[model samples]
Target chain A: MYIRAAAGISPQSSFEQILADPVPVTGSRLQCMEPDYAKLIDPKMIRRMSRIIKMGVAAAIQCLEEAGERMPDAIIAGTAYGCLGDTEVFLQKMVENDEQLLTPTAFIQSTHNTVAAQIALLLKCHSYNNTFVHRGFSFENAMTDALSLLKDGQMKTVLAGGIDEITDTSHTILKRFGLYKKEPFPAGNIFQTGSKGTIAGEGASFFVLQSEASGNDYAQLTGMDTFYKPASGEEIRQHISAFLERQNINREDIDLVISGENGDMKNDAVYDMVYQTVLSGIAHIPFKHLSGEYPTASAFALWLAANILKAGKLPGGIQTKKTPVTVLIYNHYQHIYHSLYLLAAC
Target chain B: MADLKKQIIAQLNLKDLKPEDIGDDQPLFVEGLGLDSIDALELIVLLQQEYKIKLANAEEGQSVFRSVRTMAQYITDHQGKSTA
Candidate 1:
């Protein structure tokens, strides 16, 4: 399959703006740069919409409009913490009101599949729709299933996306779990922090994928694999090598390597091993500095990787002045879920 | 009934609307306020949460919820009727 169109709403100004210069997070918290959603979302429907729904729906519509498609053959959305704001509201209302009078709107839109279902309803697309929620591997699982659908001749064009939102209350709870830093640190230097936790961030990345490469292709969706709880760094090396070998390529053949390094001193060390051992000589691109940290931050990594393949030049960071032919994307979340995706220039 | 508009605005998160925008006799459905079925459900909660009133059933809900005036009348007529 090929990625025909891609759009991401992150902490940066716009997805296109970050392709060259890294924009320091434009917010105090790692919240997405809210565009004028009034242009994309209906005023009446947006009354009860949380920020996540607005970001997700706007990004999805942007991707489809870029592809010039009114409706996709299938809609698959992957989210780690779906509708976090609404979930918190529903729960807080339950506790505050003694569980007596609760509005059903929040509870209805709190489901993980709400993004996918909303897209389906908006497009009037009654095709195969699914939502995957497997923590860090959520987006990877959705892409894997999308590949299966195309392989089985089920659908030609599929809109696959990853959406996650963060709430202050939920971020506070996650901080209690030691997911975010105890002390305030500069958001721009997140990847350089030698601390225990990284800054919390949220975003939504959407891609319109088709079976064959068309004239509007950004890059070809070559291959992807996911792993859980790999015993050691040596295991990751084995998996990386095997994945490349299946495509009749060598580890060195991959021009650029993109790793999800969120500067968590403990977990990011997992990628350090792979970098030192296998990709020591290979140029690496770090994206979490720009996107912050989230369960599906890897989805934003895909958006960056595809643009790198299209622009040929690796743009700003790193010393790779020449264009890359093949890009390898490796992402790990809290040492539990690890994934690799390969993208070749179309 | 002015309080009702404020309550609906706050509860439903209608960020753009104000109390003066909603007419007391204006219909609350598609033509007047452009509220959907979900907003209607939210209105039901708003009524119970604000006033001590319980709509007997869906059949009676239509007449009571026809307009802000009608809703205020229902609340006034059943001031002593408490659902709690």
Candidate 2:
């Protein structure tokens, strides 16, 4: 499939801005720099939407608008935690009211599929709608589904996206488990922190994809593959090699690699291992500094790679002037959900 | 009644509208307030949690939730009844 257009609400103001100058993530968490929803969604609808829903809907709408599409043939979203703010509200109310007198809005909108359903409702397009909630593999699985539909000729255009939001309750609980770094570090030095925990990141990225090229397409999504819980770093390297071989792409064909290194000592070790062996010496850049570390963060990487491929130049802060024709995105969340995406200039 | 309107606005997340914007007898459903079935349910919870009035019959929701006046009347008649 071809990524005709992409839009993301992330920690940076815009992808262009982030590429020009990497934003400094001073704290352990990187929150999405959201756009004003009043300009994108109706006031009536905005009143009821929680933050995550607003972010997801706004990104989807912006993506469709950029594609010049009124409606997509399908809407598919992947989220590890769905409507988390609403979920927190519902549970809090359930406890406070002792299982009685609970309001319905929070309960109604707390489902994992709410984002996809809300997008469909706003578009008034009664097409295929689905959401994947597989913890680390959520976004990759959603992309797989979109690719299947397009390749099968079942849909011409699909709005595929990955979204996750961080709430105070979730952040606190996750921090207790040591998921984020304890001390603050400059965002640009996330990989150099050499800390035990990575940063917490969240974002919503949507892509308008079609089977055929739109001539102004960002990049052609050649293929993507995922592996879960490989026993060793060698196994991970083999998986990357096998994926590239399956795509009929050689290592030399790839002009750049967007590595998912998030500053955690152990996590960076995994990428370091791969870099030493199979992915050695190729132009590689780390993206977790810009996006923070989340289950669906590879979505941000995909958006970055597509834009980089389309622009044929790396963002200013990275300092590479090479024009890349083929880009590889290799990311694994906590060394469990590993994925590779190959994209080429269309 | 004005307090009830404020409560309703707060509960329903009607941020754009103030209590005074909602007329006492204006329909709170389709035509006037553009609320749906979900908002109706929220209003029911509001009555129970805020006024301690448990709606006796679900069928009566149509009349009790018709307007701010009707809701206030329901609360006035049902408060102190220990429905909870």
Candidate 3:
């Protein structure tokens, strides 16, 4: 199926602001600050949701609104750490209170599937509702599930998305664990250094997908592949060749390649193989410096790809060098996961 | 005292609480406090936030957060409690 309507909420901006510029990071170290919850969620319910759920709900609603539909056939979401802020709060309570008295709000909100479940409850969507949490491949896994379901001819329109939010506590933990760079790096200039760690980030991106193309269709998903183990440069190059061959497309056919270059020297090296070997001639764009490295960060890249396909104009911030983008191959690799997606203008 | 009621309401984040309405001997959980599990967690924060008493077990919390009466008594019992 093709992506009909899309909406995203990141540290960058909401749907409206995103449509205006839609560029890669002009500076570096981008973090998705939250939008106003009162605008997207009900006042009564707003009191209950954590930042992640609120962002997911807002993006989901915005996608539906853009699609000119209320409920999709299925709603699937992916998150690496579900509501970690609430989880931290709950755990603190457990540890401090010594298991005597407890509150259920944080526990209820901390569930991995809370975003999907909340959306389902609000829309009363009794159809297929699933949430995947497999670290970096969470969003890719959800998209894979959606594609399989579409192939089965069971569902026509599916709403799929990925979202993750960072709290102060989680940020501290990640910093302590070396998931983030120790040095004080400006949000801008993140890509300048061939550093080891990328800046932490959070955001939500949602897409309204259907089996049939619509007037607002952005791109068609030809193929998607995910690798579990850490692939070396040669191995990654071979895998890309195989993947493109399976889709009957060559490296030259890929007009644009959005590489997940998060400024990490080791991780960014993975993309170098593709840039130097496979997609040497293709226009390569990176968004992690702009969006920051979140679990579902690829969703924003998917949004960028779709918009680029629709606009037929490469936004200034998104360009590595000036070139027209017709066919985009989005390559994303995180710890223990690598995903490649081929999207072409429909 | 009315001050105690106000303190409880403010500490627990009982947005619906009315200072004058909370009797001295009123319950704090399902009945008077009307707090659910999340609120109870908040109450644990409240204990730290206010009285600086830290109960490290759910069983201990059950006793501490039983009622306004019990809570005040616990606070009075464990004077000079420090925050976690």
- A216 in model 2: Cα distance from truth in Å? 0.9
Interface RMSD of 3: 4.8
TM-score of 1: 0.95
Question: What are the candidates' individual DockQ scores?
Answer: 0.84, 0.91, 0.20
Native contacts retained by candidate 1: 0.94
Point out the higher-scoring one by TM-score: 1 or 2.
2
**What value does the lDDT take at residue A344 in candidate 2?**
91
Q: Indicate which candidate wins on DockQ.
A: 2
True contacts kept of each: 0.94, 0.94, 0.28
Give, for candidate 3 chain A, the lowest lDDT window spanning 10 residues.
A21-30
Candidate 2: tens digits of C-alpha lDDT, residues A1-346: 8999999999988877976676787888889898889999988888889999999999999999999999899999999998999999999999999998888899988999999999998999899999999999999999999999999999999999999999899999999999988986664577777779988899999999999998999999999999999998778888999998999988878889998999899988988998888988788998888899998999999998888887776864455446888899999998899999999998
Q: What is the TM-score of chain A alone in each candidate?
A: 0.96, 0.98, 0.92
lDDT of 3: 0.77
Model 1, residue A24: distance off in Å is 2.4
Ranking by DockQ: 2, 1, 3
- Displacement of the residue A337 alpha carbon in candidate 2, Å: 0.4
Better of 1 and 2 by DockQ: 2
